[model samples]
Target: MFGTDTDARNAQQPDKPIICEVIDPTGTPLNVRATPNGEEIVTTLSNGRQVIPYKVSYDEKNRHWILIGDSLHSWGWVYGSYVSCLSA
Candidate 1:
């Protein structure tokens, strides 16, 4: 019953935002790239940092990359494997 209220509210709102948290296993900050698997490092996210995922992409090696930010702006691309997402 703890999350029942929140779940019901989310169920009623199909357009509710999805929240993601950084979960890098290496215990280091996760890099946010300018592009999927690109050389440019736009920023970094620490473990447990929350972000909103907007889109997803795959690299040549099939590595999953997620575009994260808010509705009005995008932060950058982060490795999908290093993040855990939940609907909020």
Candidate 2:
């Protein structure tokens, strides 16, 4: 039921497609969270890799998390600190 095209399109998208580079300083892969929190790691996204941002959210702690994924995959949340939005 999730990851539908209409659902993704209807989700809060950016003004434009935002591509970001993973900037994790530890050189380890970044955790892609199922939610906008550290406890729910879904997968690991490598540093220096790019992802398309779909939505942005400010958590209770004031940290911004970006919803990222490609057309071929479902979106996942990543902490904004580890991502640098690049020009399209």
Candidate 3:
């Protein structure tokens, strides 16, 4: 059988595009921390830092808090109000 060429493979994954919103009061940073959480122990933007949220989770016990980070102890239960959906 013959094969067909499609540009679909070259298309980017919109579901998890490389984008992160500034949850902190300030979004700019002279430099940002690189952790499993990507921004754990972050500058909170007060120090002027930026980060990309690769992963996010929710917790029932901490309904108002957000579970951030991929490593143990690295996770943070920050207020849901602090974060926003990273735009493309």
Candidate of highest TM-score: 1
lDDT of 3: 0.34
Order the candidates by TM-score, highest first.
1, 2, 3
Clashes of each: 0, 0, 1
Tens-digit lDDT track of model 3 for 1-88: 0011111211123464333233554444322333322345553333312233444333444223333333234333333334443344
State each model's CA lDDT, in order: 0.75, 0.71, 0.34
The TM-score between candidate 1 and the true structure equals 0.77
Q: Which candidate do you rate higher for TM-score, 1 or 2?
A: 1
Ten residues in sequence with the least summed lDDT for candidate 3:
1-10
Least well predicted 10-residue stretch by lDDT in candidate 1: 1-10
Per-residue accuracy of model 2 over 21-73 as CA lDDT, tens digit each: 78887788999988888588888988878887777666788667778898677
Which ranges in model 3 have alpha carbons more than 4 Å from their true place? 1-14, 23-43, 62-78
| Candidate 1: residue 32 lDDT (0-100) | 96
1-88 in candidate 1: lDDT tens per residue? 1133343234234486678888999998999999988899988989988887777777888666778876679989887778877766
| Shift in Å, residue 10, candidate 3 | 22
Please report the TM-score between candidate 2 and the true structure. 0.75
Worst 10 residues of 2 by lDDT: 1-10
- Candidate 2 C-alpha error for residue 81, in Å: 0.9
- The estimated TM-scores of all candidates read 0.77, 0.75, 0.33
Residue 36 in candidate 1, Cα distance off native in Å: 0.4
